[model samples]
Target: MSFIRPEVRAMFLRWREALVGAAILLLGLYWSFGVTPGLLSWVGYLALIIGAILLFAGVQRGRARMGGGGPGVVQIVERRIGYFGPLNGGLVDLEAVTSISLDPTEHPRHWIITHEGGPALHVPINAEGADVLFDAFSSLPGLSPGRVASTLKHEGTAPIVLWRRPDLEKRIARLH
Candidate 1:
């Protein structure tokens, strides 16, 4: 039920800072030549500084986007995973994925996947920020909402432990 993803949190913070700074700067400008001129001027300067910092952060994010490392493609498959020994709860099929995108405003860090006839899953992973969790999950292979759902019985919950197959990990390591 969480609307905002973790990755987007940083962007929100930056925006809030920018707005507050702008308001303070406006107020300072209004009272520049009025009572307590020195104090008002200092307040205005502080506001400007805060606003500039926020704006700079936002601009830096924009630059990352321009660099063109787009989010990976997600294809949704409706297959379920059952117990299989050590990997009973860890194996995930690649055929199951819906859509994937990297819009920081929405879901950050984790990819939000909605199964055809199942619950919506959010797979958390390392990302530029919490809001970009989607990018991190989508970037990796064999990890989709349904795949995660198959292993984890919880939805919209935290600390979902994933037990990837050691063989697969070894193969990945070899490739790397």
Candidate 2:
């Protein structure tokens, strides 16, 4: 038995980033006034910057969930991600993934996981258990967690490539 409903759980995941930012901002205020005052009051600015970044992340996350959810539930276990969507879905190995892209212009937004010699798998951002992906993708080298959340609100019609295998990037560079 679980204390939190799945829907509520998902909702929390969706807004968690923003909530974190708010907390940081509050801490900054306390640091400025309570912990360090006068000359060190400027320290609060650090919190403000961090809070803004976190708040932005939260906004983008909320944007991704604008449509409630599409036709899928994602599962991540032992470095493998499985997506079950209505029309199409499949599993992909985290290590074998070539790149992860965010297609924000889509109806509900999607995370396109790509692999060499295989068609990409599309996972809706608002799908149940989609929150697991944040941790999974965070493990990748040279990938920024803030950037991952920020790209959820990318302002473009085309898909935004969030991260690519170093080898893939080199290969693309060679092709050019």
Candidate 3:
């Protein structure tokens, strides 16, 4: 039994990080501007810095959620990426992925994972439990998790390869 409405609660969950960031930023700004000229000012400055960091991180996280629009949840466990969506869901081994790319043309950008002789795995960026992918994807050679995450928000019209296995990379290099 709860007083909160379901839709309102869902919206809160969706933007919780950004909301927290906004709260922190507001507190910092209030303290920095409202307080007297003393040691508290220094504290206010620290808070401001922390708040700014949170705001930036939170905004990015919110964007991730917005971009990851999909029916199912995404989970990363033991280096396997699992999707439990309404119409489709499956698991893929991170270690077995030969190439990773960001398909920016999609509505909520998708992280495309390709493996030898297997259909590409499409993982929505905002899928629940997708955050865990940072570490899992970081383990792939030549892949930068930070770069991958940063690109997730970009609404590019073309697909960008985040990482490629040495064989594929060399083949492409040779073609040039």
Candidate 2: regions farther than 4 A off:
1-13, 16-68
Clashes of each: 22, 0, 1
Top lDDT model: 2
Across 1-176, the per-residue lDDT of candidate 1 in tens digits comes to 77898668645553553455556556655555454767767776665666666554443333233211233322223443211222111223333434332223333234344334454454332222332332234344654533332332234444333433335558779998
Better of 1 and 2 by TM-score: 2
* Worst window of 10 by summed lDDT in candidate 2: 61-70
- TM-score per model over all chains: 0.26, 0.66, 0.64
TM-score quality measure for candidate 3: 0.64
Q: lDDT of each structure?
A: 0.41, 0.81, 0.73
What's the C-alpha lDDT at position 68 in model 1? 13
Better of 1 and 3 by TM-score: 3
Error of 2 at 11 (Å): 6.2
Better of 2 and 3 by TM-score: 2
All candidates in order of lDDT, best leading:
2, 3, 1
Candidate topping TM-score: 2
**In model 3, where is the ten-residue run with the lowest total lDDT?**
60-69
